[model samples]
Target: MTNITKENFDKAKNFYNFDTLYAPVLPGLKATVMKHQDAITDAFYKELANDEIAAKIVAGRVDQLKATHKVWMEELFNGEYGEAYFNRRYKIGETHVKAKIAPYFVEVITSSLRRSFAQILVAEGAVAVQAALAILDLDAMIIIGAYHEDRMHRMSDVTGMNLNLLETLMSFG
Candidate 1:
């Protein structure tokens, strides 16, 4: 997995326009998201439960998953997208890998999260929606990226090959 160094985190902040764009709207967005976070968490997990395999994957951990997801949901709006935040998001990816979740599930979860939050966020108006989305985008991107990186690293470790060679092999028909 990629290290969540300050430089990496700052680059993410810059790419997402965290200071100029996201920060201004985050306070209100945070308030709104916090107000509705329970609904968001419930909807997200409920969506997860609708899928047979996913439901099995989460079978015995719904409560724990809901609690962790609630924190992640609220944290997105908290306006503190720093190194610690990046590390936390990266850890989310690690957890997914450890759980043997397919990378495609990240996309599904992100979609579910968007569904759960979009209408309420839209009510906050365009700027707020955009800002909130920046955070969500960062969260999903980090999780997905970390998931792939860690998987690649694990493969490399097992095969005693460098990442570039592994990448080439993976790309083969």
Candidate 2:
């Protein structure tokens, strides 16, 4: 296990507070999200479709998949990042499972956006660092939530795990 010193933990914790020294930097984050939303999503799906695993899983429903995905993407630019924001993300993950999409695609989406965001940030002058951090943190949550849902659906398919199991696992993560 890695040991976390108080100073290090405090630095990490402060990264998400938005009201800290890093507060002003978050608007840049919002700008980045808004500026690249469609391009990022389009690139993500293209990368996803090229992958054998994702292509097979999401073959026939690209439009529906992109529809639900647009909702998830819109939240990033909605300018709210409190408890409600997180709940909505988890809900998106659940929606993906309902639509029969695998959770792994979430990672695919997040990683693709991160790469795109990184390139944009580098060209964004001094404000990009904080924006990049915020992107990293938020994307991690959505990706992991989707991954959790994927696991729940897989378990259910293989072992006949009930709907309750899926909901319970979703809630836990």
Candidate 3:
């Protein structure tokens, strides 16, 4: 047990080693997604298109929106989670807002992402993929949190309205 714990810890630590230690481990994340992007996308689109709420929201925007979504998915597997990547993410969020997509779609996207990750993890292997996904999930959560916070703050400033009031109304959520 001690040895197993140590091994997992060591493996987790390599994610931030700033070396190639975690690079090869990422092939599973990329390879599986690359091989099954179509299936994943199909599943995603099916969910979105069939969704009574989101379908009405995403309608008419699907054709143009797919290209942006495709790039975002590819960028994730490409390990390009840099500053520009973050900017693009926020931009897409804003685009969704402009397109009248409900905030609920964010939850849907998160759920879909989790399912896709699980499929990739199982297809690749459990042990290594689990460790790598741990790091990836943590890092992604941190970055996404920061990005969303900044985006909301910016929106608050631009609209000159307090979003906190709206948030308070949705506190039950």
Candidate 4:
């Protein structure tokens, strides 16, 4: 698990232009996000239920999923995009990879979330399409960063093992 230090968080925030692009609309978007949480969560799970692989991963865990997802949504809109936020998001990515859930399924879930929020925002006439996209893009970046970080860690482990094996073989020679 990446420690999500302040340095890396700042790097990611800067790389994503989160402060300029996302910070401005975050305040206005919070209420809108909260208002549509249930619909978004339900739709996410509904899609998961339909997918055989995802359904198996979530089987017998519906309530837990809902509760945790709700909390995650709340944190997302809480306007505190700091170390804790990135930490939790990174951990979610690590959890998905460790559980062996396919990355495509995670993409599906994020797409569902983006679609749900876009519909709500557009319907209420509260946010412009461009701002909505920035928000969704920020969300996607964080999620994708988590996945990439986890994969890098796994790759590091494998590389370490391969190097150790090469060293052992050299010793035998």
The candidate that wins on lDDT is: 1
Measured by TM-score, the strongest candidate is 1
Collision pairs in model 4:
none
- The digit string of per-residue lDDT tens for model 1 on 12-114 reads 7798778888876787777778888888888888888999988999999999999988878777777677667878888887788889888888898787676
Q: Please provide, for model 4 over 120-159, each residue's C-alpha lDDT reduced to its tens digit, 9 standing for 90 to 100.
A: 7786464444455555555556666666656655666877
TM-score of 4: 0.76
Across residues 1-173, which tens digit of lDDT does each residue of candidate 2 receive?
01112223334446656444444565546665667767776777788789988788778988886776667666655555555665665566556667676656665666667677777777665556555656455645554555554665677889897856666665586
TM-score-wise, the better of 2 and 3 is: 2
Stronger candidate by TM-score (3 vs 4): 4
Q: How close is every model to the real structure, measured as TM-score?
A: 0.84, 0.61, 0.61, 0.76
Which sections of candidate 1 miss by over 4 Å? Answer: 3-12, 164-173
Question: What ranking of all candidate models by TM-score puts the best one first?
Answer: 1, 4, 2, 3
Give the Cα-based TM-score of candidate 1 against the true structure.
0.84
Candidate 2 stretches with Cα past 4 Å from truth are 1-15, 19-24, 28-35, 97-103, 142-173
Question: What CA root-mean-square deviation does each model show from the true structure?
Answer: 3.1, 7.6, 9.4, 6.3
CA deviation > 4 Å runs, candidate 3: 1-24, 127-173
